[model samples]
Target: MTEHRPVNITGLALKIPPALIFILWIAMMATLRYIFPGLNYELFLTPYVVGLFFILGIFLVLAGFFSFRKAKTTINPRKPEKTTAIVTSGIFRLSRNPMYLGFLMWVIAWAFMQANLVTFVFLPLFVFYMNRYQIIPEEKILLSQFGDIYYRYLNKVGRWL
Candidate 1:
């Protein structure tokens, strides 16, 4: 029915690995917090944490929204669609995946501003999951759809950065 024979792993499994990685990362973060309550090593909870995250998160959200708006097809993950345009403007210039980046900002904001150990777990987990399952699969689709142009962009810009 499709052009290429589907790979051994289903999309569901591809999606779950990253989520699991994130979950494990969160667990580790929880252990760290539980074991050492006074640790502020990776915690970026300055006075600016609240406002900084607020502004940054908002920007990220807007960027993602704009990217989706500019994109040729739907952002729905269940149904894969070919993207006609390479969005290099607005937030796309900043981060390849602004929406997911926004989600990351939310995780960091929730963790630091609220000083909640449990919520903080989502930050790392989200990165792991998105990078492994979501971003990886999306890249494959993008490459297949965009071909050389997509590869050129991949070389020019990073996945997250």
Candidate 2:
């Protein structure tokens, strides 16, 4: 008989598409601000910070998307086994997960826009969830699928730059 792996009873592992999760985080952040209006705080140069982060967010996202397109590889995050090639071009040179990084930047931008100190809490939570549920799982699949080739690439690149 073939080997069978244990599965997550919650059916969450490697199941939810990361974009959906990102959008969920955005919604949650906005909801937190709504629930606690007084949580809003002020910072110096909020507009400039928001502008810089938002632009950087979108830029990294598009760069990562296009890099995958140029490489003609899979962009599906929920299914890492679908990946056809190791992308090491463009933004991938700087970050192994630029799209995720962009999503994080967008979260920071949203937090600034809300000016809610409570909203800022989601930053670390976002990183934690993504790292635990998404990145680590993806890394395992890529490592298994690509073997030593991907291992070397992993050594050379940071997960988020």
Best of the candidates, TM-score: 2
Clashing pairs for model 1 are 18-129, 22-125
After TM-score superposition, the amount by which residue 40's alpha carbon in candidate 1 deviates from its true location, in angstroms, is 10
Clashing residue pairs, candidate 2?
none
Task: Pick out the ten consecutive residues of candidate 1 with the lowest summed lDDT.
Answer: 1-10
lDDT of 2 at 127: 89
- Candidate number achieving the greatest lDDT relative to the actual structure: 2
Model 1 residue 111 lDDT? 62
Off by over 4 Å in 2: 1-11
Over the full model, what C-alpha lDDT does candidate 2 score relative to the true structure?
Answer: 0.86
Model 1, position 95, has a per-residue lDDT of 74
Query: Could you give candidate 2's per-residue lDDT for residues 1-161 as a string of tens digits?
Result: 11323333234667777788888988998999989988788888999999999999999999999999988898988877788888998899999999999999998998899888898999999988888888888887787777787889999999887
Models 1 onward score TM values of 0.68, 0.90
Q: Which stretches of candidate 1 lie over 4 Å from their true place?
A: 1-47, 80-82, 116-121
Q: At residue 20, give the lDDT of candidate 1.
A: 49
- What lDDT would each prediction earn against the true structure? 0.63, 0.86
